[model samples]
Target: MIYEICVDSVAGVRAAKEAGAHRAELCANLLEGGTTPSLGLIRAARRVTGIGIHVIIRPRGGDFLFDDDEYAIMQTDIAAARQEGADGVVIGLLTAEGDVDAERTRALIALARPLSVTFHRAFDMARDPFAALETLISLGVDRILTSGQEASVLEGLPLISELIKRAGERIIIMPGGGITPRNAGRIVQAAHPKETHFAALTAEPGGMRFRRDHVFMGGELRPPEFDRLVTSGQIIRTVMKNTTG
Candidate 1:
């Protein structure tokens, strides 16, 4: 099994590699459910790590729904990521009515051609998961990143299992959200996924402290969002070794 760790910063990507992650999904703002990283950060990550770096192609936060200009931006970003030597790209698109925008999605996939495309968690918001899966498979998507339509994968295990059964090895069903070393073992045993995604980050905002009264500029925690049970390289490798062994 492969583990895809979400890294919002160049530092996080290096830390993920030290933790033995097979791949890193590079993004700018994990707090907004991940967005595309800048060329500088992407190049910095590439220079520092050998792990596969799959960049998120989201232009902004808020919703997976996109307009014409936003789609154009995404296409341009995909080309940039490919040229920058990204191992893969993560993206998704939904209609204003909350359904898969098949034509637009297909076009994006074409732009990301030859580079692996992961239909991000926007898959969870689809009106119909089964039909949507069919559309993605028909569009020749490589994989899907989803929490099985629930707020968390643990809560959505039944649907995840059902999805795995129905998928029948056609496309990858990668479970994400609320997954951790503690629960990852159970999730893997239940869903039998070939891959999983998580952000192993420690809530140590104080260590990078400048001044508590430095409110002149309101700081935002970028990338590798959220606190977790295990944030150390040791914890990540130990859990992965135990689970995949």
Candidate 2:
């Protein structure tokens, strides 16, 4: 089993390597459910870790539908990811009608070239998983990181198993989302996937000693401003053992 750790920081990249992860999907703004990481961060992560770097190519959060400018930005980001020696990238696009934007998606896949592309969790937001899976397979996507169109992988394991069985050798169905050590083994046993993705993140108190009130940098539930989120090597090893054993 390949433990693909989702990371939002360069430190997380190093931690993933230390914990024996097979790959790390790099992104930023986890509070917004992960956007594209900066080119600098991608390069820094490459310098620090030897594991596969799969950068997320999301232009923003909130919706999978992107405008022309957003599509342009995604194209640029994919180029930057390759220029920085990234091993692969993660991307997804959808139509307003809740279907895969195959035209634009195929264009981006063409631009991404030799880098392996995993259709990200936007697969979960699709109106239909089986249809989207077929679309991805036809477009030559390397994998699909999905939670079976549910809130969590465990909640959608049955669908994941079905997708995996149907997928056969056509494409990879990598289960991710709210996967923890306790349930990682269960997911592996049920889904029987070749790969799984999780963050294994922990929060550490910020360095500031001063106190403030009634202030926040985010619009939604945010991690404590004084707490920095990071990947935990212990959690990585724990989940890996549970899944692989």
Candidate 3:
């Protein structure tokens, strides 16, 4: 089975490669559920990892609907990702009515030619998964990263399996979200998907020698300032072993 690691940094890309992941879905601010990475970050990741790099094209977190300006930003990001040598890009766009933004999605797909494209977890936020699946297939999207419209893949196993069967060879249905080494094997066995996506992250103490407490840089709902989350190669290796063994 092909394994794709959701990573937020160059270090994460390196870790994913070392651990035998088939690809890295590179993003920034994964805590915000992933956003478009900077061009510099994309270039750095390409330099550091030989594995496939699929940069996420989300401008921000929260909803998949985009304003005209935000849509334009996404267009620019897709071009930047391609310029930076990314092997692929992940994107999602939805209409106010909660359907796939087919027109805009088609435009971006055309622009991202020669590079594989994955419709990110925004598929989970779609109002109708089956309709969206058909729309994406019509647009020629390569794959979709979804959790079956649920909070986790395990909870959405039944739908995931159905989606895979319905998709046939028209598109790839990749299960992602809340997957761990413990449950990876079970999800694989149940869904029988061709690929899986997840992040193997761990909190590591930041390189701060001084003490600075109570000053929230990210404003209240924030992670610890003295600690950072990073992908762990060992964790990825363990998950791979458990998944494919």
Best by TM-score: 3
Q: Give lDDT per model, in order.
A: 0.84, 0.92, 0.93
lDDT, candidate 2, equals 0.92
**Candidate 3, 82-149: lDDT as tens digits:** 98899999999999999999999999999999999999999998999999999999999999999989
Q: Lowest-scoring 10 consecutive residues by lDDT in candidate 3?
A: 211-220
Give one digit per residue, the lDDT tens place, for model 2 in 57-93.
9989999999999999999999999999999999999
Candidates in order: C-alpha RMSD to true structure: 3.2, 1.1, 0.8
The predicted structure with the larger TM-score, 1 or 3, is 3
Lowest summed lDDT window (length 10), candidate 1 = 222-231
lDDT, candidate 1, 25-100, per-residue tens: 9998666888999999988888765799999999999888888899889999999999989989999899877788
Clashes by residue pair, model 2: 206-226
| Candidates sorted on TM-score, descending | 3, 2, 1
* Residue pairs of candidate 1 with colliding backbone atoms: none
Cα lDDT over the full model 1: 0.84
